[model samples]
Target: MPERLTILVVDDDQDFLGDFEVIGRDFFELHTADSGEKALEMLKEEEPDAVVLDLRLGSGIDGLETLKRIRETWPDLPVIMVTEHADVDTAVKAMKQGAFHYMSKHPNIKTLHAIIQKELGSVRWKNLCLEEIRKQYGEMIGRSAPMKEIYRLIARVATVPLNVLVLGESGTGKELVAREIHARSGRAGHPFVAINCAAIPPALFESEVFGHERGAFTHAVSRKTGKIEMADKGTLFLDEINSLDPDLQAKLLRVLDDKAITRVGGNEVKRVDVRVICASNQDLEKSVAEGSFREDLFHRVNGIQIVVPPLRERAEDIPELTRYFSRRIQMKTGRAGPVFSGEAIEALQTYHWPGNVRELMNVVERASVMAAGREVTVQDLKLASRSGKSQGFFQELLFLPYKEARQKLFSRFKSVYLSELIQRNQGNISKAARQAGISRPGLYRMMENTDE
Candidate 1:
């Protein structure tokens, strides 16, 4: 049996609330709140699939404020606003504040039930697709929308024998996506050869890609097989494809078209069945326009283009990625891994990861190894922002609720100010209190409260 969906109804009308209980009993598991304060409390406890809120409450904060607060914490949850006396201005305001839908109280309960069902239907389908991707792609550690779309694209393009071009910054896992496509395709059992175009010298580029006969050049002591030949009946991934020399690009285009390669200094042609997948951190289109990369080769290798999102764009996945790296470290070292504090994770999410996922993995591994105890704090991560300031102080507050964040900011300010004042007074509380324009006892109390 399918699990029943849950909804929270917030209103002050006792009689209408009772009627809704009977009306929605068959379709949903219901929770009721009489005021906005109670509704926010219930939101944290119940975590319902959707919320039905009244525009006006008899006491405390009204529906609009409640909706704004709900959006702050749970931005993706569906919220439908229903009022007994809905005005055009009020409905527009609620919609602007992120209400899923605004509806006036109607005589029939079926209309309200239908709206909820329609909203949740899409949410359920997305979640189901995400679950399937999770089961299949275990190496990709993200559930964000961008990652989900990439998973769907990979699934669609895996079976088709077409060239793929992956575009992303360095360390964004472009090669990982190519490998995933190869793993899911018919070429899974064959070799998945990879070569870095930028790492090879221009002189050896031809010999490295296509086999050369014995004595083809000074270094060619014997007949050698190249990456393309080694990856026969499989996938060949060329990283930094934009760095390939223009002369070699034309030759590669010819091989891709003919599905064959001719050995250097030899007449025999070799027929090979290889699917080519290329990746470039640089802009290949701009490179082609600049007369560096061949436009013909560009189109040949770019049958399908997949762009891997950078790590900074998917900050929500940092905690999961952190846990994954920690687990791997534990397995490798045969010891308990360091557990990251909540603040540490928040600091990580706020960082501008210019190096992308590979950089994140390195940071996690380093922090785990250097941690003095099992618990790793923000200081252990040692993150610095682009401005060269520590990320633990101000940037982390972006992830917290407004009230809590304000309080933390004030507390941090107090700690810094009071410590400086006391140090300037040479540890004399009386002199520090005089300078701060407060009584000595009051200064002592402030120090006690802000300690650590």
Candidate 2:
């Protein structure tokens, strides 16, 4: 059976809260709090699917202030604000504050119930769609918030024929994202060509991307088709696109604008229908600002931009990723896969992965081959010590109680790990926060608490 959705209702009126017992019993599990203060406390304990907050609390903070705090922590949680006396000004304020819906409390409880049901149903459908994407795209893994948002964006842009720019650190599977988009797009039947812009030599770069006529240049014995032509009616993914030569960037821009390409040493302009997807590890905006990249070409390819979070940001998916890698190794060797101990998994999660998913796969494969037994212990996974302090840092937590250990681990990790992260980004909090997959304000708060 499916699990029941939980709803947290905050109201000062005990009589009004009691009405939910009869109305929501069949549809959801309901939890009630009398005032805004109690509601905030309940949020820490109960992971509610939706919140029904009263606009005017009899005591404590008002609903708007409570909603503001809730948005800071749980930005995606659905909130429905209901007031006894609804006004246009109040409703506008609630909506602007990120409330899912604003409504006046009517005598009939069914209206509110219907709204909650509809919202929950939409959430469930979205989750199911994400799960389907996960099952279909084997190469693209992770169900973390960042990955889920990427999946949603992929689904939204798959049908639309627009150039896309994928930005992420190396080994974050930018190519996999491009492939998934092509596989789900309208041009699935056609070719999906890929070229690493950084790998090709400067001399051969133009010939590789745009085909050459016979005897056009050295080693051009016969007329050749370029990546764009090969991917006609399909997708052309340019990996490490920031490395493209300035001259080629202009040529590429012209092809995108005209939907045609001219072969080297040939006057014929070939018309091709190809969707372009560009991936870059470096900041193309900075390159454009420094005059190293063309601003016009950047705009041409950046119709839609998608940023893939690094592995450290989605550490919750580490264990599953480890399992998947272990299974692949087992298939190749025809042996049983290794089972990771809880401590080993936790150790993996604590490490700051600079190389992202590719690095994790390498670590898992190495550990699987080196493990003495079927169960992989923490020692089997020889994780590199970051700054020579991680070994002692994690060892210190082993003696504490589970709750205390968790708190201490998080606190220390925020101080040490986040500090190093910010430093690595050269004190740019926005860049560090993006790599860490948290809001800038959230990072500031964590850093401030660490200082305290």
Candidate 3:
């Protein structure tokens, strides 16, 4: 895509790292992360094209765990795992986990160069294709058949002032559709007020929907206009219509039927000329069947119904959705956000996304924060889930690059560990040495080497 692809080589083996960097410098913009944590931080700072990840990262998140997070965040980015864990089991695990290629430690420079180029060569064109797709979908970002049908319905209903009911799961962007319809309607010049029916308490719901008098209640100190009054000449979006209380539901039905609303604790009725748009994640028909929701109110509001497809049902839209969210993140947060790697988008499509578009956006936002100096890796995505917790020791490390992977297991061999342990003891080399089961002079020697 660019003149030279960026390659991040992460290995704690100093000699091997030096050799690899020397070999890679000519062919790529080289970056290095000795630990998985630094590698991840680098990824957020700037997204590299590919990573030469050693299977053994001594501390923070292990190599495999880091790879997993990278896939979660940047599924499309290629990761080439290099390790002395040359066993077939390890190779198979790495391959199944989506590593682009796997090689034993100390790979031939020529071979490594070829693999890196091959993995990254097509990325530029792929990115161009994605950009084209993003431009094609102006606002509604989906190409699935269900969405196509929904578009037709939107066009048909936009001009009419019919009461519209939007049905879908939570986070399916029902509110977006309502806004689109209002924007296209004749009342576009007027206000488009929205209220979440389920969010308001039952006691306050009526007063919220209908204007309230100054002395209507203890808290009612002055005349207050409600959502219905606010949308007098425009559209009133009542979200979560099923959450409206039975009594409030009846009052709302009267307003729709009579085109007027009487303020709370007032005798005079004020007329209104407004269109109503209702949205609900709960199935109003089922609620009506159970007698928990009023049938008359449902009939009054259900002049026309629009069903928004869940994200999983329309997976084709995710590419554009991710791009949309990325652009929005830049505008909203005022920062350059991470681009979705091809691997990352595929992983997102693979997910069931029970929380729908909302969850996907949340994952993207979090990934942007963790993109590092390189692109988001799979590891970032896995960590984005609020419930994500490390499943440590899931697999045996017998195939690990024992010398490097086990470095953290042996504290005396680790300079970073020595420095941190010394600091933890408030720079008291004696206590640190005692706790580390090492002589004071041994700690001093380690510190001297660390300084060197």
Candidate 4:
């Protein structure tokens, strides 16, 4: 049988907690905290899978304060801010503060269940090494061979503070990888702030990185902190760092050289202690050789390089990844559809995936929404297959070591069988359970075991 999820609901009102318990009992092994202080204490004893926090807790620490404290201590904990005082500002603030989602005091039970499912999507990687990735990037959702290797590399690197340069195509989630690195390293508890060098205008580059005084510029009315200063005592991810101009590159070199920054229009040099993780899609070496990027700066940030392989290379991971994307889309849209057929999976595996994982995500999302029925067909994938393209069966085997190779084949068989079971019963859980000679709970357990 599937193990029950443990959930803690914190509210000042005793009656509300009672209602939550009644509604959520079947879905979770419920725990209640009447106060934020008591919730924190209980959390220390054992962390809950999810938290339902009321915005206005009586006295001591209010919901916002408690949320801040939780983010400081356990940043990964999923929190749903429940409140009657629902305003646009409060909702935005709660989300920015890292509450999983915001809900009204009296939410539908179905909505609550949907929220739980969404929150659980992010709860993973308890392994310290992988936990670092989860803590930083939220979740790394791909069971593909390439992604598995990336996860393995993350595990290996999380313990060391190496200046990692993640190389990948533009939309391939390099920042996500950088966050994983920071989360896994000794700096996991600290901030993993990102600054896109290409996004900042040349006029504001220095001010963006090093901040400025109140009167630094004509329109500057107040003292503003820079990205680097904000990332002090934490990990600073320079996304598309190759786009940084030579002058700013020199300034960056100085910062790395002296571990300090001189704010725009400021005479005093302020010390900053931070771990730098730079990412780029450009040919950084060629750029350095061509005088567009600094060679010395390249040396500084290239201590450890991780090349994120393109999605096409790891096409075997398509099915599980498709399911993952499907689940997320389902949660987001509050409507589940476009379950992939075998031919559809094959079509996805055959695609070039020129845009890589990000592209695949978009395609899957669109296909799910557009498909007439719940089942996604090969045509839904929109990949033009070559008339005589090799099945690449042998190529799939080459990506894995012997143990993993065996496991993959076994897993594939299990997945195919499970799909057939569900299809044969027309998605009737109890009938399928009876046909498979397993209890209802056991069926759910098996479903969880397989990524299907």
Instruction: State TM-scores per candidate.
Output: 0.58, 0.58, 0.58, 0.55
- lDDT-wise, the better of 1 and 3 is 1
Candidate 1 clashes: the total is 0
Judge candidate 1 at residue 277 and give its lDDT.
95
Candidate 2 per-residue C-alpha lDDT over 1-452 given as tens digits, one digit per residue, 9 for 90 to 100: 23456889888988888876776576668899988878866775555988989999998899998887677445567899988999999899999998989977643455666776687788788779767866767578888999889989999998998899999998798999999999999999999998877656666777878889999987889999898899999999998889888988888889999999988989999999999999999999999999999999999999999999999899988877887798899899897655666567888898887767877887788788889975577788767533244566578678889999899767756765775566445577876776577888998988888841
Could you give me the TM-score of model 1 versus the true structure? 0.58
Residue-level lDDT of model 4, residues 211-321, one tens digit each, is: 998898998888888888888888999988898889889989999889998888889888998899899988898998898999999999998888887777777666656
lDDT of 4: 0.77
For candidate 2, what is the TM-score?
Answer: 0.58
Give stretches of model 2 more than 4 Å off.
1-131, 385-452
Expressed as tens digits, the lDDT of each residue in 286-384 for candidate 1 is 998999999899999999999999999999988878878987988999987666765788888998887688778877988998999756778888676
